[model samples]
Target: MREHRGVPPILTVVAILVLGLTLSATAPAAVAAPTGKPGDVVRSTEITDRPEARMASAARVFDVTYLSADPRGRLVEVKGSVSLPKKAPGPGGWRILAWNHSTMGLGDSCTITDSLGKDKRGSRDKWLGQWLRDDYVIAATEYQGIGGPGVHAYLDGPVAGKNTLDMVRAARTVVKKYVGTDTSNAFVSFGGSQGGHASMWSNSLAKSYAPELKNAATIAHSVPTGLSDYFAAIRPGFPNVVVPDYVTYFSYVLAGLKVSRPDIDVDSYLTPLGRTVIKNAQRLCYAESGPATKGLTVGQLVSRPLADGPLLPALRQYTRLPTSGYGAPILLQQGYLDVVAFTPLTGQFVSRLRSNGVNVTYRTYPTQLHGLSTAQTLEAVKWANTRTTWPR
Candidate 1:
C-alpha cells in the first residue's frame, strides 16, 4: 500500500496539548465510561494553532482534538470558536450552536475577502459569525484532514460522522471556559451543502454514537450527496458535474471501503481522469472546482453501472438514513431553490422520515439557493437554545 500521508499523530499530541488546560486528562482510550451511550467519554482535547485576528471577535476560538470511533482510526481533529452571551439558553444553562462549515475548516472561512469583498461569498461567507454571535456558543469544525493529517474524508459518511460527532463532544468539553455547562445541556448541530449532510449524520448517530447530546438540529442547503442519487441525477446531461467531481466523492468512499472490505480495488473503479482528480483534490480550492468541472459530462463517466461492483453496496450503507430515529427532536431546513441537493430529493427523504415515525420539524425556504438558508439557520439556533441550557 502506498503511504497516504497528511494526518498528524493526534494521540501523541493530546497530553502535551491539553496540559495546563481546563479539561482534566482524557479519561481513557477506546473505553467508553458510564456516561451515556456506546462511545461516550468524559472529555478529550487536541493541539491547534491560534486563530487569526479576524476570529477574535468571537469570544474565543481554539484548536482541539477528538477521537474517531471509526474502525479506520482516522484523525478527527478540528478548530472551533465559541461565543457565549451573558445568559445561556434553556433552563438558564448552557446552549451550544455547532456550525459544521461547508468546505472550509471549522473556522468561519466565509468571512475572508478581498478589498471590495467581491469573492467573499460561497463557502467563506462571514454571515455565520454575525448570525451566531448573540445566540449561543458557536463551534465550527475543520474535520479530520484539513489542518492535521491524511486526506480529508470529504463527504464520506462514517468519516464525516466521526469528525462531526467527536467535534461536538470536544466542543462541549472545552467551551466551559466561555459558557459553563455540563456536556449534557442543549446541543444543536447545523450545516449546509456537505455540511447539511454532516448535520444529518451527526444528528442521526448522536443517540447511539454520542448519547450525551440533548438536541440535534440539521439545516441542509443543496446537499450534494447520496452517491447513488447524485450519480443518477447528473447522468446523461450534466457530465461535468458528475464525471469530474463524482470521482472526487468516489475516492473518499473508496478509502472508507478499504477499511472494511480490503479486497475491493479502488484503482480499478477509477479511469485515467478519476486517478488524477484524487491526486490533486487536496490542492484544488473553490475557484478550481468550478473551472475543473467544465467540459466534463456525466455520460462520459457512467460508462458502466457503479452498482455492478462492491462500491455501490458500500455506498448504500453510506447514504442510507440512520438505523434508529434520534432520541432528541430534529429540525430539517431545506432550500427549495437548491439545485445541488435538489428540492425533490430532500422532500422525498423528509416524507420518508415522517412515515417511519421520526420526530422531525421540516422547514422549506424559497429564494434561498444551495447555501445556508436564513430561516433554517436561525431556527436551528433558536431550537438549540430551547433544547439545552449550556449558554445560560
Candidate 2:
C-alpha cells in the first residue's frame, strides 16, 4: 500500500530491493567445506536459536549448503534453508514450494540466512511458516553467493532460476538424507520483487534444466520484466530525481555482469566513477549500495549509453524474462503504482504470455506491494494449491 524506493527495486525493483540477497564468485575453495553432488547436501544443520525456532513453528527447520552451476556451468556453492512438515504429507506426498528471495546485497556479509535470526525478518519467517502449515516443504535459496561462493547474480533471472531450482533439489536432498523423509517431485516457485523475477525463470527453466522435477505453478509478484527496456529507459545527463534511487540498479546489473559475463568487459562500458561505483556495489549490501551510489543517475554510471555498448544484448540475454514457454500455470501480481517494475511493462508481459498460450492469471494491487500482502499471499497460495501437480 506504500511505496519505498530508498532500497531494492531490481529484484526487489532494486525498489527497497528489499530482500537480503547476494550472488557471488567461487567460494574460497581454500576454506574447508563439505563436498557433494550439485543438489546433494553439502551441509544441513537445524536452527536452534530461540527467535529462529519461533519462525519454524511446528515445522523442522534446517540451514543447508549445496551446490549450483553458473551460466557457464561452473560449480558454485549456494546456501539455502529447508523446512519440513512435522506431520505426514497428504496422500499425494509432500510437494515443494520454493522461495526465491529478493535482492538483499551481493556480498558475503549480506547473507540472508545469517540475518534470519534478527527481529526484522519475522514476516519472512511467517511467510515460510505459512507454506509449512500448508504441508509443503519450503526451500529458500540465498542465491549463489553468501554462505557459499559466487556473486548473487542480481536481476539475472537465468542464474536466479538455476539457483532456485537447485535449491529445490538441495531441499529434497536435505529432507531425505538428513531427516529420512522423501518429498514428491512436484513444486511451485513463489517470489516477490526480485524473487518474483527469479520465480519466472525458475519455472521456465524447470522443463529444460531440472527435468526431473515437475513445476505445477509459478507465482511472481512485483516482478521486473522486460529488463532490456528498463536498461534503455535511462539516458545520460538526465535530470536528477527524475528516477528514484532505484537507478542504483544499473550499478547492480553491471556489477553482476562484471563477474557473470566477463566477456562483455563491463569496465569498458563504464567511466572511472562507474567502475568504482560498481566495484563498491559488488561488496556492499542493498541498503548500503543505494547510499553509496547516492546522487548518481543511470547516465552518470556509464561512460556511454548502454545501447552504445554490448551491455544491452547481454542484458537482454541474461536478465530479461521470457513471456513464453511456461509449462505450468503462471500468476503475476502487479501494483499499479509501482514505478520500479512498471505496471505497463508487466501488462505487456502478461499479454505476451497469454498470446503465447501460457495460462496466465494477472492481478493488480493499488500500491507497490513489496512486502507481503496478506490478501495477496493467501490468494497466491490458494491459486498455487489448485494448480500444483500433486498427481504427477
Candidate 3:
C-alpha cells in the first residue's frame, strides 16, 4: 500500500471530498432531478490512498456516484470505483480499462468495491494487478442496483452497458480533478459471466448511447450466450438431473427480472415453495442464496416449465446478444468444460457475430472450467492494450 509521490494523502483528501449538491433551478425538466447525462458525477469521495491487497499498484481509490439511465430512460444514481495507477500519466494521459464484474448478488452488499479494504485477494486481482503495473486506470461498475437505489438488474444487457460506459467517464472526471491523474478517453471493456454479457452490450450500444467511447475493444470470457437454449438445458425435463446445484442462479434471474420488468409476475412462474425461496433470495447475496437453493430440483422450484409460459418471449428478448452493430473489435474466450455458459453455445454466438460482419477472435481452452477462464487475463490484457493503442 505504498503511496505515489505526487498524490495527496488519503486522510486529507477523504476529509475534504464533496458531498451531494442540490439540482439547479434552471435545469431542464427532463433532467431536473438528481439526474443528468450519463457519466455526470453527482458526488465523489476519495475512499483510500493506501492500495488494497487486491489492488497492489493503486495510487488512489475513489467511490463515485454518477448518473446512468435504466432501459426506459429513468435517471438513477449508480455507484462504482475508480483506481489510478502509481505511475504518472503520460503526455496523452492514462488509458482506461473498464471492468464489468460477474454476478455477486442482488443485494446492496455484493458491491465489488466493498472488497477493496479486505486483506484477501480476488481471483481476478492477479491479472488486474498486471494492468495496474502497466499503468492503466481501472474503472469498475457495481452494476445498476448493487450499491444504488433500484433493484439489481442482473442480466439486463442495455442497463448494464450504460452503467459500464458511464463508469469510464466518471473515472476520468474524478481522477483528473481529485488525484491529478490525467486520463485519455480511450478505453477497453472486459468481463466474464454476467460481466461478459454487459461487455458485449456496451460494445453494441456504444455507437448510439456513448459515441464518445469510440474504437473501444472488448474481451468477454466465459460468456453465457443463447439464453433460450440455456434455460432449456437447465430445466428439469432434460434427460438427466441438470444443474441441481445451480438452481439458485435461476432464482436470482427470476427475482431480477421481476424488478426490471414490472409487467411480468414472478409468482406466476413459481410454486408455493418457489415463492418462499425467491422471497428469501431477495434478502441474501450469491454465497448465501446459492447454498440455500442447493438440493432443490428445478421441478420443485417452478409449477410449470418456463419454456411453455408467456414469459419466454420477453426472456429471449432481454437475454440474447444483439446480432449486429458492434463498432469495436471483440475477443471471446470459452472453456470446453464450462457447464454454466456451455462451450457449444459460445461457439454459436461467435458464429452469429461473424455472420453479422463483426471482427471477432474466438479462443477455447481444453481443461479450463467456467472460473478458470479468468486465468486468461494476461493474454486478454495484451489484446486490449493493442486495440486501445491502435491508431484511430
Candidate 4:
C-alpha cells in the first residue's frame, strides 16, 4: 500500500486479494517434524560428504533424526547414523547391530556425524566398518542430546538405552526404504565405555520398552557401573587420591545435570571456579576437553560434597546401572587393569547381575586396558551371532 501510494483500482484490488488468498492456501509450509513414536524416523538426510559416506561396506549412509524420550517420558528427537551394508543379505535378511558409542561429550561437534566425518575418526567408525563388511545393518546412535535438543544427559542410562533401541527401529525403516530388503527382528546391542553403559541399559529395557523388536543379546565392554559409589568419593577435597580424568568425567556429569535435572541447580553445586570449568566442559568434546583437565583435581573444582544428602539421590539416579530386568543374555567384557572403567566397580556390577538371577556371561582380560578390548570384538560378535534370536 505504501509503495502504491493510493488505493488500487477495484479490479486490481480484487486480483491482489485473490492472489493473497491463493498463496496463503497453496504456498509450501516450512519443514515440520514427523509425528513420532519411539524409533519413528523424523527425517533422514543422505551423508554425501566424502569422508563421511566412504564406509567400506555401506550401500548408503544417512544422518537420521528419530524420536526418543527423556527419563521423564517426554518425547524428544535424537540424531544417529544408519549404515546399510553393500553386500546382499542371506535369506535370514540383514543382521542388525545397534552400536552404542562411548563417551564423546555433551557437545554437538562431538556427535557421530562429526566423528564419522573428516574432523576425527576414532576406533568407532572403524568398528562400524567391520560390521558393514560382515554384512550387517548398523544403527549407531549419537545419543539424545549430542546433536539434538537440550544438553546431553551424560551417563543417563535409561535415556541412552531408549535412544539406542529406537535407533534400531529407525535403521530397519531406512534399510527397507533404501535397500528394499527386509530386516531380521533380532538385533544386538554392542558398545564400549559409555556405550557399554548404554548397551547394558538397552539390554535391560528392551523387553519392556520395545517388545516389538527382538533384543537377541547384548555385549558391553568397559562399561561404567557402581557410579554412585565412585561419585560418593567426590567431596570438596575427596577421592582420597586424585586420578587422571576424574575432574573431566565428573564435570561432564555436572554439565548433563544442567538439563536433565533442572531442579538440582547444578551450578549451585559448583564453586565459582567449578562453574567456569563446567561451562567449558559442556562445549568441548572428549579429545579436546580431556587434555584440558590435566592436573585439575576434584578439590580444586568443587565446593560441595556430593557423597551424601540431597545430591546423593540424584547422582544415583543419573549414574547407577540397573542390575536386573535383563530379558536376554549379556556378555560383559572388562579389563582388570583398565583405568577408564575401574575394575572393582565392574566386579560389583557383575555380582549384582548374577545375584539377581540375570543370565550374564562375564569375560575379563587380566592384561587388557580400556581400549585394548578391541581385539576381542571379533569374539564378542561371534558370541552375539550364536545367541541371536532369528526369525523362523
Better candidate number, 1 or 4, judged by TM-score: 4
The per-model lDDT (C-alpha) reads 0.53, 0.75, 0.77, 0.80
- Candidate 2 minimal-lDDT segment of 10 residues: 15-24
Q: Which stretches of candidate 3 lie over 4 Å from their true place?
A: 1-33, 49-54, 117-123, 232-245, 373-375, 390-392
Residues 1-392, candidate 4, lDDT per residue (tens digit)?
A: 01454665997889899998998999987656446599989888878455755465567778888899875777788899887777888887888889888888888888864335443545644655677777778898988878887678888888999999999999999878777878988888889999998998998899889998888889899887776777677778754344557777888987776667777766666787888889888778988887887767777776777764567788778777887889888999988888878898888889999999999999999998885444588778778767666662
lDDT of 2 by residue, 1-392 (tens): 12456664455556232332322243333555445556766777787454543354445677888788765676677788876776786656678888877778888877765344465646655655677778888788888766567666687777888888988998888777766667888899998888998899988899999999988899988887777876775556645554455656777777877677878877776777777888888789878877787777767766667777677888788777887888888888987877677888889989988999999989998764444477678888888877665754
What's model 2's lDDT at 81? 81
- What candidate 4 gets wrong by more than 4 Å, as runs, is 1-34, 113-126, 239-242
Provide backbone clash counts, one per model: 27, 26, 0, 0
Return the candidate ranking by lDDT, descending.
Answer: 4, 3, 2, 1
Model 2 scores a TM of 0.85
Across 1-392, the per-residue lDDT of candidate 3 in tens digits comes to 12347655875566445321222444345534574788999998877654452366677788888988765668789989888788888887887888888878888877776455454746445777677778788888888788787788678898999999999889889988986656777788888889999999999888888777664799888887886665654443433356434667777777767776767766777788888887666667878876787767667777667777567777777777887889989999888888888898889888988999998999888988885444587888888777655432
Candidate 4 lDDT score at position 384? 75
Q: Residue 358's C-alpha lDDT in candidate 1?
A: 75
